[model samples]
Target: MKENLTDSAYAAGWALVKRLPEPVATRLFDGIADFVWRRRGKSVLRLESNLRRVRPEATDAEITALTRAGMRSYMRYWCESFRMSTWSRERVLASFEPEDVHRLDEAMASGRGAVLALPHMGNWDLAGAWVVVRGMPFTTVAERLKPEKLFDRFVAYREGLGMEVLPLTGGAGTLGKLAQRLRAGGLVCLVGDRDLSASGVPVEFLGEAARMPAGPAALAAQTGAALLPVTLWYDGTPVMKGRVHEEVPAPAEGSKREKVAAMTQAMADVWGEGVRAHPGDWHMLQRFWLADLEPRPEESVLPDPQGVQ
Candidate 1:
């Protein structure tokens, strides 16, 4: 499993992006989206399969249109992440409506420490960066990218924006840090809708069973953290729109699995409301439900959040 080729490809792509201006980046992304949509290869096939899984009743033409929209959304996220350094704080804050900020404020002021759960729906990196600019730093978990160079580069970029990325390494790395922050009344944001790691708990989504990461729910149960689902949608606007759900009730007095399942359902309900409002903004590019068919034989050593890191 040599990752040199993958690393090289991404590095080259990012290098080209690093040199582009905002307007040029937008145009380049639009072009890339057009190119990806016109193709009928693995990328298109995977997108079509995911669309069918999520929206089975959609017509073939409807699925194709959704795939194109997903591709564009995905590209827009990448482009925006690269351009984050160039964005002014005023521009970033202006991206969200005042009502959205009000909901987030209400959730955070609950004093239980808000866990902003986002999906792969929109520009989440940008969303987190926006919070940082607004003077509220948050903790989010990310699986380390392959090739140490790329991983370090991403960490540097994110940390520069006041985010503390917890890497999914063995023992007290990311998750341990997350618990400490939450207990101390810090904001913890996680993307709970998709389990990119391929190891997650099965939950009903969009009227079908889909697997999502159990970490957010598990953390909520372990600690009395408030879980809030947040999503951003483009909606043909230069500045995107955002939605936020109030802090969900954490199932603390239940069995671990039951509590996690309840929390997962709460998260699913929040995300479902957002997706229904902006179906075109949902950006899952690969198959999600079928990943359970794949085995997760190797379990990593996860640290106890109660233990001090």
Candidate 2:
């Protein structure tokens, strides 16, 4: 029963929100963010906790203000997502402003394929859409949302945007499928910041020990693809901004496991820099550090991110 309501809510969001005027929809989502921020719900408090680590020197009042800004940024992501399906190609291209995109071009030109590892700092879906518009349709893995139907909705939505979506679990062969795409000179984008599976490569992130998914690093090492870390953020306008960091190279003379670990740690360091540079745009509103998750080991590990990317 609860699952049905959750699915219906998202269904309504896609159906109705897309039809509203741009300014009206923006104001509506901003209002919703403020309301939730004022309530200081579990999600809000969790965001506060995570932000403290990001800005360790912040005073209480500053943290409070930061959290509110973070909530607004998060709500902006949702607003952009709900209406992305309705966006035209020109709009999609115009909205995303990323630096060093030639890296993607060079990687693909090498015919070894490329893997874009992105943090949940901004609307990654928009970035993906921008890529698709440039004629490079990529494949991505999605963590299955509960109430099965909601997950299906997400898949269809991304597919509609010219992406090939794979399930994170219970797919025909997730790792093999990704490798096949890479060897064919195709692109794969993965959310690298969060580890849905607890068994992940350990790394120090944001000044604490945290586990980050090794898929990006592993895929790059196995297929000889370029491993590029991309961080995104909103720059207080409708335009979304991002950067493509230099690719992480596999360490010389290391076992596959060692190489993966080193690459993942490098990726984590890049992510920490991105988050610090734009803390509010990072939509991390859940437990992230090892110490934070130790006591609540069995809690839901899935991020409250509106889009899995």
Candidate 3:
């Protein structure tokens, strides 16, 4: 019953938000963000804590201001996502201006396939739409949500945008599917910043230890695909900006396990650069760092990267 209520609430919210005028919805989201920030909601608090790790030297006043801005940015992502399905192809193509995109283009053209590792920042859906417009439809894995209806809704949403959605909990076959896609010169985008599974690869991020999903690196290593880290943030109102960092190639000399670890750390290092530049756009409201996590016995054992593949 509770799951049904939650699912219905989300469905209703999406319907209403999509129907709203752009200006009206933008203002409404701003108001909502302001209210959440003022109330110090758990989401806002978690975002603030995450920001502190990004900018440890920030004063209390600065942190407070940044938190408010972060809330606004986070709300903007929600607003854009709810309305993205209504966006036209031309509008989606114009919404994002990418930097260093040639790296991805070249990889795709080479027929070696490419793995795009992205952090949770900016409007990733917009980026995905742009990629589809550019003529390369991609596949992405999504975490299973509590309410099955809600999970189905999200899968439908991405599918409507021309992406092939796979379930993270689909077991070993999931990774096999992704690798097969890559070997066929396909694109696979993975959210690489946080690990949803207990067995994520440990890495140093933003000067602290954290676990990030190893699927991106493992996929690259297994398929000999180009591993690239991409970062997205708002350039201004209604415009999204992104940068594709240099590719992290699979090390030819290391063991597969060592190569995966090294590549994962390299991706983290590039992600830190982007997050630092636009801290507010990073919508990392949940616990991320090792220090922030509660003690769990299973954490000591690395989970198979295939779990998220």
Best by TM-score: 2
lDDT of 1 by residue, 7-74 (tens): 67556666678678778888898888878778665556666676776677889898888878877877
lDDT over C-alpha atoms for residue 6 of model 1: 57
List residue ranges in candidate 2 displaced over 4 A.
294-309
Error of 1 at 227 (Å): 0.6
lDDT of 3 by residue, 11-110 (tens): 8768999999899999998998898889886667778888999999999999999999987887888788888889899989989999999999999999
Candidate 1: list runs displaced more than 4 Å. 12-18, 171-173, 196-199, 291-309
TM-score of each: 0.86, 0.96, 0.93
Model 3, residue 93: displacement in angstroms? Answer: 0.5
What C-alpha lDDT, on a 0 to 100 scale, does residue 4 get in candidate 1? 72
Candidate 3: misplaced stretches above 4 Å? 295-309
Q: How would you encode candidate 2's per-residue C-alpha lDDT over 1-309 as one tens digit per residue?
A: 978988898899999999999999999999988998998877788889999999999999999998999989988988888999998999999999999999999999989899999988898889999999999999998878788999999899889999999988878988899999998999999887877446778899977988888889999999989999999998888899999899999888799999999999999999999999899988887777877765554332223543333
Best by lDDT: 2
